[model samples]
Target: MKQGTIHNKDRFLNKVADRLNRKRITEEVQLPTWSKQPQYEVFDGLSQDELLDQFVLQCDAIHTNVIVTEADKLNDDFDKVIQDMGGGSIVHWDDPRFESFGLDSALKKQQEQGTDVHCWNYQLGEANIKKAEQANIGITFSDMTLTESGTVVLFSDKGKGRSVSLLPQRYVAIIPKSTLVPRMTQAAEKIHEIAKEQGRMPSCINFISGPSNSADIELRLVVGVHGPVQATYIVVDDK
Candidate 1:
């Protein structure tokens, strides 16, 4: 990707500093310490198993199916999810973790059985969006999970199209145990660390909680109004 250039960045900052009756400060500012940190207190001492239980309960409230399985059995569980969703065309991200999590075999098997399987291809560009639109299901690995909200965080890139999750009729997120956190507070901190380490940020970061729903029509709740009608999370015990 081409790096963006800032026009007169120093001039802009200098003007702001001048208005504030101070010179431009080049030093890093220290973050203020808060007196009470209640955000960290929720699920602070919970074990991973406890967090998983909470996550499952939250998912149920949101109408999302949660499947807990071992990494070794991910292939079978994934296949079952596909079958349950009424297998047809499927699209997934171009992420190698699918193979690491034992899902590649399932995807390959589906293809061999004449099921349409499309992996997001950067080279194909807009064609990838078309495939996602035509797909019955779209799959992706969660970059970070918020157990409090039953949310799956996705960092979109060239190979990981946002359409893979939004355009499909159904969405599937593969969540590793280690990726689960107490809530968005922890997820935001991790994302800040990633941006600092990488010296750049992803084009898009999506925090999806359950299926697409809206209450716009006569104040009645409607599902799948703007995105996937059905969503599922397969949590792998890979920690």
Candidate 2:
């Protein structure tokens, strides 16, 4: 047994030595010169308007409801979404994009109407986390929307907690038309560029395609197992 172990050890070390001595390939890999880059080809024919339309359509197909509203009507639309979902406690990110539409006033109105609404605290204290976990709805400002996959990208950081999208029974994402990209690759590239410029990437970048779901146990379909069961995307025509 000792002899066999020694032989096997010798064989492993010899293989390691061979691998170490091998020349490393350093040739610059040329990316495919396809005009649409193969991956983004699906977005080639989609116009800006069509991109938004396709985003809504694809979102609907994935069991996610999409609502389109003009910039001026964003406050009304927010009320409509919360009302449609039966007005409940909500926890949302502290993004300036929402503030552009006077979110504070809208939130105050909702609170006055008996809806428990709170913004995520950048401090990330335990009490705030508990509050978010108990909330019925989670609202977030999407970094970008991918038309092809109906995905909403969210960069999590100090003021943006991943729990805001995961702990609640329902999720509401506010997406601006200007942030709509035709493909996921473009979205990823944008993130990469931001990281390069910012010197650091967000701790967690969530690409939510739809509500959390699984069909594993007994091959039975289930929703909200790990996150929100119902997801809504409010796409506003605001640059």
Candidate 3:
């Protein structure tokens, strides 16, 4: 990842340092020690399977479906999920993991069968958004998942449009077991580590839990007002 340059950054920093009556320090700052840390105590030292169980329970409360499958059967399971969701026009992020997980052939087969399948293309620009808006289902691999909130974190970029998740009628997240964490605290720490190792962070990070829900119109609950009406998570037991 390339670091983006900010114009007059040095001048702005120097002015801030002068106001603080100190020179600009370039050394890394140490994090503060919080005396009472309760966030980590929740679901502490749980096994991966235990975390996943908690995640599924939370998903049920939020009206999202969860499917568990093995790596060898992921292609079949994924295909079934799509078919169960009505198997119409589909849009997905242009990610290589689809090929690694043996879904490329499945998607290609769907295309051959006259099902409209669109992969987010950076070169196509707004054309990708238009396709996503008209798509019946949008699929993407979850970068990280928080068990406590049943939230899937998406690291969006050029080939991974946010519209693919927000504009579709239904949203599906493919969660590799290894990516599941206990809570958002762990997710934030992992993101911070990435920012430290790489020069730049992802362009967008979406924390989606379930289908869009609100109760603002006369206190009446509404689903799919702003985004997908249905959500599903396929958790693969992969290394």
Candidate 4:
């Protein structure tokens, strides 16, 4: 064995051996039980109605626009959002949920009417990234909406790429009432459960509260500094 390699191995082994008998280290470490409900009573007695109300209030506080629409009339509402923003190119996640909601068909119809629509597919490779970057609007589905923080959680999957939310000038999320959770703790627990069931977590899990803003430059509070300047959340009352 080379003298340098042997010395490195001995140093590593000595470091490990020194830590084994350290009296200052405690073996019984207690970590916060993230899966359990927090002891704080802020959300304890809140009803579903109260939660939704709080959610809207918090969203407004964070400069996020919330639109409530009936589940059946989502298509119309979606079209209204697009029209209000004017006809332009849109990029969206290619999830089955979007397909089931006929969003794909609606986009295709818009495309035939002279608007550009791009569905993100990994097969398209880097082209999808470019399309998302240049799109006027990007739409995605929220995995969970935390009522307390008015946060939307997005987990990247095969059909849902992170760029669909991060790359556009305007980002839109279609959230179902059923996906609403109480707070961040519950949301984390749900993500842990998903990981256990799937045997792995997604590569990226984004928690988005509102439009991106930063006060770093002269503390002037610039919006869309690094991300979409405008974000809209459409909550479908599927109940």
Candidate that scores best on lDDT? 1
Q: Which candidate wins on TM-score?
A: 1
Predicted candidate 3 versus true structure: per-residue lDDT over 10-126, tens digit per residue = 899999999999999878999999999999898899999999999999999888999999999888888888999999999999999899888899899889989999999999998
How far out, in Å, is residue 234 in model 3? 0.7
Kindly give the stretch of ten consecutive residues in candidate 4 with the minimal lDDT sum.
1-10
lDDT of 4: 0.84
Better of 2 and 3 by lDDT: 3
Worst 10 residues of 3 by lDDT: 1-10
Cα lDDT of model 1 by residue, 1-239, tens digit: 67689999999999999999998999999999999999999899999999999999999989899999998888999999999999999999999898787688899999999999999999998899999999999999999999999999999998899999999999999999998999999998998998899888898999999898898879998889999999999999997
Write the residue-wise lDDT of candidate 2 on 104-210 in tens digits.
77888988988888788967587668877899889998888889989999999888988899888899998888888888789889998988888778889999988
- The residue pairs that clash in candidate 1, if any, are none
Clashing pairs in 3: none
- Model 2: colliding residue pairs: none
Decide which is better by TM-score, 1 or 2: 1
Better of 1 and 4 by lDDT: 1
**Once superposed on the true structure, which residue ranges of model 3 sit more than 4 Å away at CA?**
5-8, 17-28
lDDT of 4 by residue, 1-239 (tens): 12232458766766777889643443578887667545445577777667878889999977888888886788888988888766589999988888777677678788899988988898888999999999989999898999988899999877789998898899899988788778887888888998888777887999998888798878888778888888889988767
> Judged by TM-score relative to the true structure, which candidate is superior, 3 or 4?
3
